[model samples]
Target: MVTDQAGHPLFTTSRDRVHAEGLWHETFHCFVVNREQRIVLLQERATGKKDFPNCLDITAAGHLLAGETVADGVRELEEELGLVRTLDQLEHVGVFLEELTLPGFVDRERTQVFLTESNQAISDYHLQATEVKRLVAFSFDAFATLGDETTTEVVSIEGERFGRNRFVPHPPEYWAMVERSIGQSSM
Candidate 1:
């Protein structure tokens, strides 16, 4: 489904057309964090993915099809990460507008972002092979450091260090918003 700049429905079109034309569409992004441990979970996109393949991204995310309500987007969690959760089980952060342009593809999205708190081990996640390659853990403190301009790398819980290039590359403002939200989230 395509929509206006504000996410109000306008018309329906194929997914390829939506990205090809840079038509604004709705999407859901869920970040799962373990508040007590100050850790966050991120997923590695499968190498075969059309966009941003092999990059780390939100714990779970997907496009919201035509006629689906925002609440229904929670299904992405179960579909992508095998985590079943209800709308009430997550915190709706806010709707954000994201625009990314490549040589041949453009993506304009009204993304509904949510935060889910969980302490489940990485082994507990059953990843959808085609969408997610693997799950990784990062310390919230280290992630928050990314908000600083000079902070160049963050080490994952497993001891591997990575820079922003490892991520899907959201704008710095988006990362700032995520850092602020994580700081305010309660157990």
Candidate 2:
């Protein structure tokens, strides 16, 4: 688990808290896109994770270490997603909050959202076993429809050794937001 600048758990100050003591901790989130207007990606979190297992998060995301800046953590995409894009290749989409409802979860993050465009096939890269379990590709619309219909599609993991596939259902509003983000990024 990642800690805040104060070296404390983020759940201590979530947005939902009246005094949100931990909300002061900063974090970042980045999104990637392609020229075809496709949002670059999101991975199916492995079920063994401590939080939000098997859920869909940003195309590429991680917490900023206690002394790290939002940009520093966002740069992890090159290693996590195996993209060769530079910091300039990423475009910030401002910040967003993903509050946790698991009571006393003491977490509120200032997500530094970003967007980028790339055509690189993810199959060439490797998946971080600790962070992601597999991957899936869908046009923004396809995901939107799946979200609205509660359809769980398959995601395949490509990594250093082999790949694994699994089915997942994601939030519809997220794709709707992604579509809008992609549209805005293209502009």
Candidate 3:
């Protein structure tokens, strides 16, 4: 298997591996935790989408194309949220695989996660219209209680109305990384 400079696996085939085919588009997701650590901003994907439509998910996330470095998070920050960021502004928490099976295609994604603390509200953001629709900020503790199958869901953002399971999207590993970072700072 061919690999990029970072050693991430590239695209392939049975006989000859098509480098362009498996260039592996990467994505960045930011968990903007507030000062009191009470609220976390969440995004609601627009209804008109081919994959993961209308899901209540992380605050801001997007893919990093071929040749894009993980450090491009700063640029992504500006493009996705129209905010400026320095390398020190964002904490590179972790990387994890997020797999999703849509109707025709499957997204086996390698997501680079980040966390930052700020008083800035997303209301000041001018989001990318093609990718993002609306934003929702919720309390962190309350969000943890969500996705309870036994509890009745008043509104299903990621699941069908009749579906029993509440989908808490995003890999738990990413969150765990942020917790680790906090632990380091306390020491």
Candidate 4:
């Protein structure tokens, strides 16, 4: 679906065309956290993915298809990570407008983010091999620190030592919004 700057519906288009033309569309992002441990979940995109392959990203996320509501986005959890959750079980975070430009594709998204608490171990997840490579847990505090571009610290994720560059380069504002959401959810 394509939309105007304010995210009002304008027209519907193919997903490929939307990315190719940088058309704005709705997306859903779910961050599964273990609140008791103050750890957040990150999924490694499959290596064969066309964009940002193998990069650590939100626990589960996908674009919202035309005619689907934000609640339908929860299907991504089951499809990607084999975790079934209902909208009522998730805390709805604020929507954010985000844009990313890569060599062959552009992503302009009006994203609705959500958070859900889960105590499941990383190794217990049933990953969809084609979409997710691995699931790892990281300290929420350490993840927040990466928002600072000047930070030179490297932290280990899974078995890899990752600097900020190792993850997807989402805008700093997006990180700030997510940090604020997480902070509020814990209160």
- Identify the leading candidate in terms of lDDT: 1
- Cα lDDT tens digits, model 2, 1-187, are 2445453554433333422344545566665555564534666677787656776666667666555666577566765677666666677666555444344555555556677776767676577777777655555654444334444452322222211123222235544565667666643
Error of 4 at 51 (Å): 1.0
Best first by lDDT, ranked: 1, 4, 3, 2
Evaluated against the true structure, the overall lDDT of model 3 is 0.57
Off by over 4 Å in 1: none
In TM-score terms, candidate 4 sits at: 0.92
The better-scoring model by TM-score among 1 and 4 is 1
lDDT by residue for model 1 (106-135), tens:
999999999999889999899999999999
The residue pairs in collision within model 2 are 10-106, 11-105, 11-106, 11-107, 12-106, 13-22, 31-114, 33-116, 33-117
50-96: candidate 4 lDDT, tens digit per residue:
77898888899998888888899999999999899999999988888
Minimal lDDT window, size 10, model 1: 142-151
| Deviation of model 1 at 157, angstroms | 1.5
Query: Which of the two candidates, 2 or 3, achieves a greater TM-score against the reference?
Result: 3
The parts of candidate 3 lying over 4 Å away from their true place are 1-25, 146-168, 171-187
TM-score for every candidate vs. truth? 0.95, 0.68, 0.69, 0.92
Q: Which of the two, 1 or 2, has more lDDT?
A: 1
RMSD of each: 1.2, 6.8, 5.9, 1.7
At residue 161, candidate 4 shows an lDDT of 68
Error of 4 at 7 (Å): 2.9
The CA lDDT at 103 in model 3 is 48
lDDT of 3 by residue, 139-171 (tens): 554444454434444232333242213233445
In model 1, state the lDDT of residue 162: 82
Model 1 pairs whose backbones collide: none
